[model samples]
Target chain A: MSVTAPLGFRAAGVAAGIKSGGARDLALVVNDGPARAAAGVFTANRVKAAPVLWSQQVLAGGRLRAVVLNSGGANACTGPEGFQDTHATAEKAAGLLDDSAGEIAVCSTGLIGERLPMDVLLSGVETAAGQLSRDGGLAAADAIRTTDTVSKISFKRGSGYMVGGMAKGAGMLAPALATMLCVITTDAELSSEQLDAVLRAATSRTFDRLDTDGCMSTNDTVLLLASGAAGVVPDLAEFEQRVTEVCADLARQLLVDAEGASKAIAIEVVGAASEDDAVKVGRSVARSNLLKCAIHGEDPNWGRVLAAVGTTDAVFEPDRLNVAINGIWICRGGAVGDDRSKVDMRPRDVTITVDLSAGPHTATVHTTDLTADYVHENSAYSS
Target chain B: MSVTAPLGFRAAGVAAGIKSGGARDLALVVNDGPARAAAGVFTANRVKAAPVLWSQQVLAGGRLRAVVLNSGGANACTGPEGFQDTHATAEKAAGLLDDSAGEIAVCSTGLIGERLPMDVLLSGVETAAGQLSRDGGLAAADAIRTTDTVSKISFKRGSGYMVGGMAKGAGMLAPALATMLCVITTDAELSSEQLDAVLRAATSRTFDRLDTDGCMSTNDTVLLLASGAAGVVPDLAEFEQRVTEVCADLARQLLVDAEGASKAIAIEVVGAASEDDAVKVGRSVARSNLLKCAIHGEDPNWGRVLAAVGTTDAVFEPDRLNVAINGIWICRGGAVGDDRSKVDMRPRDVTITVDLSAGPHTATVHTTDLTADYVHENSAYSS
Candidate 1:
């Protein structure tokens, strides 16, 4: 089921003339009742978008009644006018929902540094509000997209309620907590603190491990809002699990939709001296364009992988290191292992296992193959 | 003047069949007499090439007579056999030069992990030694290239002597001291410690500021060998300046030949709180694929530039930050400064200036536009 498939929540999506292609440019997801608690994670980039700054402050006190999202203009680096535009949009959304402006969150994605066309945006907001329905989740999901080829939404049925989310991103994606604009809605009763904890834990493993291009965005944000319509709060343990599952599902979708991506690569580092070391090594490999490109070319260039891992400070003897690509041992004891000719890397799913032989700790990072389309798409755009 | 133009040095380049295309694959550069001091820098990557490890140990005492290099195989992560191959190659070179094995430095680049066709490599060494000449510098430069489209060589006449060098790299390049293999021959006398200082200072601003694809290689190395054959070593200050100039020229050439690069972009961060901050900001911009691609498309997308700078920790009020692309102020105070139509970004050479307005420190980094050709080349290669 989709995010708005729950009770006491209504969502709508509308074309706002913001996108040049005339796709849905405005989307609204609202909670129609009793619970009004929210938590959010924003981009670590010190230069935040105007909408990100506005929503961050609004979510500070844990109250959120609606999220007003628009696709087309990022509303970033637009200075004072951008900030004012964000405020005005929030005010309009809150007015339509019969709530205070302070209770609405704002999100924008698309080209950066452009001002929002307020005339179209305002009219689109009115249309969205008029069309709001509990079953409109799928439409809303399809609305908040920029470069993403497909809409990403995930749902998890918990002990008493359900957690659902929609995310949009294809590039400028990396992670500290989350790497894209994601809005999650739930019918379970949850306080701000519990939501914060569960969101952080869930993101730590899910979104935080996906590095498509290693570019972190100024508009990256993840918002979790609880409707409390079910009137049944889940135990903290179960709530965390459900949240984590939903996040994982969403993260997987983001990876699958990474720009110019043909394969979703999983680099697993095992036998590291510590979990941190494994993560460090995995990240190094995940960010290596050479290795990624080689993988895209279907070349079992295990040496590039070794080179990436070696660049990290993680302690391990090169001789003790072992590498396997696509379930075939390519290198062992710092030397060539089995016949590399036997390894096939043309599959859409690729895995690289690096055994450090240092400790029991392990970590896995998801990445995408480098492709010509990535360069073409990114280079052709002005933003 | 080229590297071998210096007195007391003999060099040669020969085809060893290491390259499948039947190109030159072996080079031998030797110091004939009167000097034995050398200094070296190797890739910071932990998964080092076999030659890098061997040279790191041999250059520790600061004395060397020759450097034996080969293309077509990096000899990295090949385990014990790789190390053995490197040793044998070095020993053979030393034997031909009438020098100790420990006195000869070794470097190899090409495909990584594959064993060197020892039979071909050893025979090529003999051919190279027999063909050694003082005018073989250019041939040596050409012999060491893998995917590089052009030969990189530079020379400078110091107060009383001369310094010349060559380098080869087209991808898997970034600045962490050095990103590719280079060798310099100097007629001036200098100790190992002195050479180290001079090399470090030169590289700090030259090779250290180059970011091509943001990928660090496993076989990067830079070696400087002084012959002291002229017996007219000048003051260290004058010598260092000349060395820096030569390195800068070579570094620029490397950028020009960067894979799939259609334009060379220079990003300068001025008025930063500290030099480190300025460097950090410059690097952040240099490593951005979106910005690089935008520049490639001849689109002045200043928003990507601001977004990149925002990801860094440099202290700057986002609104106060001003960006000038190709000498036109596209953004000021985090907003559009002037008409974007006035800014032209169609030049092959472009400069982006970011005024942090926080301090007096500044830094500049060299990068290239990301193009479809680069993606096509890298994605098709296995190594």
Candidate 2:
């Protein structure tokens, strides 16, 4: 179960004939609730997909009764006709669900600069809406995958309430958000304003810190919906914590399944002048292609780490920097320290700790090692 | 002839026994000039190499009698001992030439973080100093090779004067200069201030635009020395142009020899509100691994181009953007335009033109396509 793990949520998935080989390409989730509230975050890239634009408008109204997602086409860079198609999709979904078009959110992923087969998609949407059930969460999650090897789902039980989420992304993962679409649902009684604040806080710490390839996408969207069917007015602090836990779980899942990744590396930056400085330093280190390759090769090349750190403007003296890999202090005070050969990098998970020795702030950024498989996967993606 | 193509210059290369293969790894270039005017630029990385630190101080005096460069070790991140090695090398070269250490510069390229063999290097400097001659430019160029397969040399004859240069870099090429060591010689009668201004202008338009792999190095240095032996006060504008031509030729050579690269891409951003915006847009597109991979696969994936353009703060409306690969405009008004199939990518050289449709300003950035070979080269680099 994914979204439907939360009470008052029903979901379904259907083959839309939009994707080749007749794979499941469409999904729907409905809020069968006494109250409906929603919040959303979209890609920071100026060029946004058609569904992202449509969903953003619906979410701005602070109420959503249903969400319809398709994975055959991103509908980005398709001009005015793409936006019209997205509008038509929402209108069709609302007509079948007996709700206003403004209450239905739409999301799309897959190839950009292409038009979706609207007839097949609309029919698939109708079939999915009719099949919506409490146990259809897993099916819905499975439908929204492009190059993803597996569907991502997570759930956390709260104090007399529950929160759950599903996400789909394989590549183009970077700051602000990955090239991903995530829908989180909860049965706790909370206002749309409260949901927005909690979602922003959770994503900023989790999703925003993931920089797999340093490539920002045009179709990244994360949504949160609340249904009051649980009839429990949960404590705000506990609610936020549960939501954050679910998001973190899903984010880690994304990391583990990053495209062609051989290692999952965490760059933890500490002793910074400020939180912003820490994040800057961590992101700089995370984006280094050479350092990522060294990690892939199991070479404890701490010099590349320091080279990456030196490229940032964060407050720190070069000679005061320290770096550790796998708990082995390979570089101390900006020079070779502990024997690098003693650091074991045979494991898939690697942690690099950087001490700026400037202040007390810290941040951790997650990334994947650069590999030949990544070049192979992305080179043939569009073709 | 490389740097020695200009009058009043002598150079030599010798085996330093520091490299494993006993290859010629030490080079000495002496400006046997009546005038010793010099100008230099170094890497922008804050954690600079010891050689860069030493050379900057020597160049600050506006005079350089000789430059000693060694391969096999970068002398970077080696703590105080690394600085000491660079100082000792300069002192030995200056002593051999009966000059002050402040007038001698040093350059090192290869693996970072390992201390160089000081005794072997000092002796090799003595051999190089004794062998210096007018015809030793080619040997000097060959000695600076790390991963470089061939030596890079360029020369342009001005009215009664000449500008010639040699550069060594195969990977880690990026903005604010590359992981390269370059020595340019000119016989034109120019002051140190004139040399500094002209060198900066020429490099900003040439070497600074080459960004292969987008990784800055800790030891990037470009030195220009004027021997003023031609006894000709060439026109300043013509001299700058000649120098820029030589720099541009060497930059292209670096691009062609970029490690594991199969295609050389020139991303030209036109119709920008400002030149900086144009360069920002061009660089963003050039750095996109997705786009680079697509180019390598010979696919006209214009959508990746738009995605990269959207990531920049450059002045452009999403719908008005246009991109053309080779001469075919595959994207216009941010949508699919002419037939992508018509774009031929069979050649090693590729040109991608992006039209921001904002203003008349424009810029061009040079880069290499991402490939599995790149991953292989960098992964095993420091091992």
Candidate 3:
């Protein structure tokens, strides 16, 4: 159930003084392979972190041997100096692993705008490299946590190859990929093109659908590395399925652990004018603070849902919209329909379905309800 | 300091059992008039409240004798019955006065999806007409409030005329007019076209820039009535200036009294490519929940500001952006610039200045920080 669950992968986590709280803040994952194929999906935010910039350039060759990640400083908005720090971190990792510096990828998380503690980070990377093992995925996942209460790890067993992944995120989660750092490993004989296609598809359906807070981060990065150690060239479709399953599992974990969230909601928008419209209406409902607040209080206030739907450009009449929560038609034809008291929201999982009554396209977005704990956790103190 | 400050306005407030809480939930304002030229702006929300729909139809003839507003029910998405309720309220107000129902406007605010109690609403309108007096503006303002801690009232004195207004709103505020109801009265003679132009301009600069919680309401309405009671012909420019001043004053009061807000933040975006771009950038920063949370915690977390700016299409170099908090330049050229600890945030008034360095256009938006109180007030068992 971890990244190292896949064959031909070695991983480790190490503590560095970089985190003043005295926790593990550095991780190393190496592909000890006969095949080195890699693909990556970085943050959509224009103001990206130094590591994101470095990794995007490094992946231009479609080859990667190792990855080094840290969770102390995001190394974002730190100017040219921040870029130099990221470059140095990659060079240090390459030196310890007998690999080319250009073939190494780097990821960073934690507070933005501060320079990383270079000395402590390099020492931790050296220690992590020495401790790397086939069963070190759990430790590597632990090292990447920021405010998350638990590390995320997922694995999907297949006919021949296996898919494994790890992720860490608790805030600034929204579109185009959540505020997250994830690394996936697979022991399948797939080309770089195959890896890229599956990675993008898997992430678009998983990471890009988590909108816990409607915030886009500057340091989101997801990487997929393939090493053909299973000695079987699996069907591309089968491999994509397994990769998507692993990502789906990781996304659910991230949503469940979203900071201060009490209810994990799945919003489905059907009968829209287009796929984009469906997603737009769904996101509008998912991000409504009033609706989220009502859900947190367990109030089946479907009026807020209709109000949110009205804010979008989706094709639907004010009198034709319909809404259901937990299979109860609380609103139909944009007015009161069924008994709202019959709907139950006592559980952590909630489903809200909106019928746009326009076309047949549909989309789903996973979100969490707003709670006082959300404000308390986010506004308590500075990192 | 209220609607009565103007020369020709008579107002009243009466108890309406429509609100189960037994608050003063009904109000009436009459133009004791010689001149009846009027103009109004209603909510941009596609799913508008019944009162918004009724008021738009009533103001189409460029005349209005009185306005009747009620709290306790938004009468939004409540189907055709809600429209009938609004029509009945207008008819009841006109029956008590020597005026036509077509010359009466109506507005309602409170929880959405519920139908207004027609019996209570009509009775309150009749009683309000009987109690109308020049000193009743304060009571009328008090009657419109739902969760507002204080009634919002403002008066702008001119050389020969005065503009006075009253507003009620504590939540569901955003641009294109906030979740607010405002009635402005003046004694100057003006055409309906002139009134429409000036009211639009005033609202565009004032009420449209207050985005407390980024949720647009279904019942936002602003009305302007001129009675020519001062027996003086005021200059159009002078009257417009007074109208803008009154709206600005009311906007400030609304921000200060925003539900559960801990601080009032003024966000100014300068050096944008256009006025629209400046406003767009400023609003993006104002609506960022992460930045609001940091402000509530009193931390100068400028990185969050940069993250929000990146989400927009505003023209600016990623490394050339700058930000200031209070009087300290905390971020310069997209990097750390000031001693963050030197900037104090103990005051309730906080100013965030962003320098886009793209062009010469600028705009400002007023907002509030997210607090645990905001979440508690919004999610506490639903109003």
Instruction: Give lDDT: candidate 2, residue A142.
Output: 93
Q: Give the TM-score (vs. native) of candidate 2.
A: 0.98
DockQ of predicted candidate 1: 0.61
Q: Score the docking of each candidate (DockQ).
A: 0.61, 0.62, 0.56
Give the per-residue lDDT of model 1 (tens digit) for B1-383: 46797899988889989888789989889898698799988778777878988999999989988888898888877777888999999899988888799988989987777788999999999999999998889888989888787888999988779999999887344222123789988999899999999998998898888887777787888888899999986799999998888889888888887777888899999999998999899988998877877788788888888888888878998889999998899898888898888878778899999999899999998888877777677666653
- Which residue segments of model 1 deviate by more than 4 Å? A171-179, B171-179
Sort the predicted structures by lDDT, highest score first. Answer: 2, 3, 1
Q: What is the DockQ of candidate 2?
A: 0.62
Write model 1 residue lDDT over A1-383, tens digit each, in one string.
46785566888888988887789978899988689888999888778889999998998889898999988878888888899999999999888888899999999887777888998998899999999998878888888887778888889888778888888876334221123788888899989999999999888888888877777888888889899998988898998888889888988888887877888899999999998899889988888877777788888878778878887899899889999998898889888898998888778999999999999999999998877787677766653
Q: Kindly give the stretch of ten consecutive residues in candidate 3 chain B with the minimal lDDT sum.
A: B170-179
Docking class of 1: medium
Q: Which candidate would rank higher by TM-score, 2 or 3?
A: 2
> Which window of 10 residues has the lowest lDDT sum in candidate 1 chain A?
A170-179
- Residue lDDT tens for model 2, A1-383: 79999999999988989898989989999998888999999988888888888888898899999999989888888899999999999999999988899999998888888988999999999999889999999999999988788999999999899999999887444211226889999998999999999999999999899888888888898999999889998899899899999988988999998888999999999999999999999999898888888899999888889899999999999889899999999898888889998999999999999999999999999999999998887777776
Candidate 2 vs candidate 3: the DockQ winner is: 2
Per-residue lDDT, model 3, residue B57, is 93
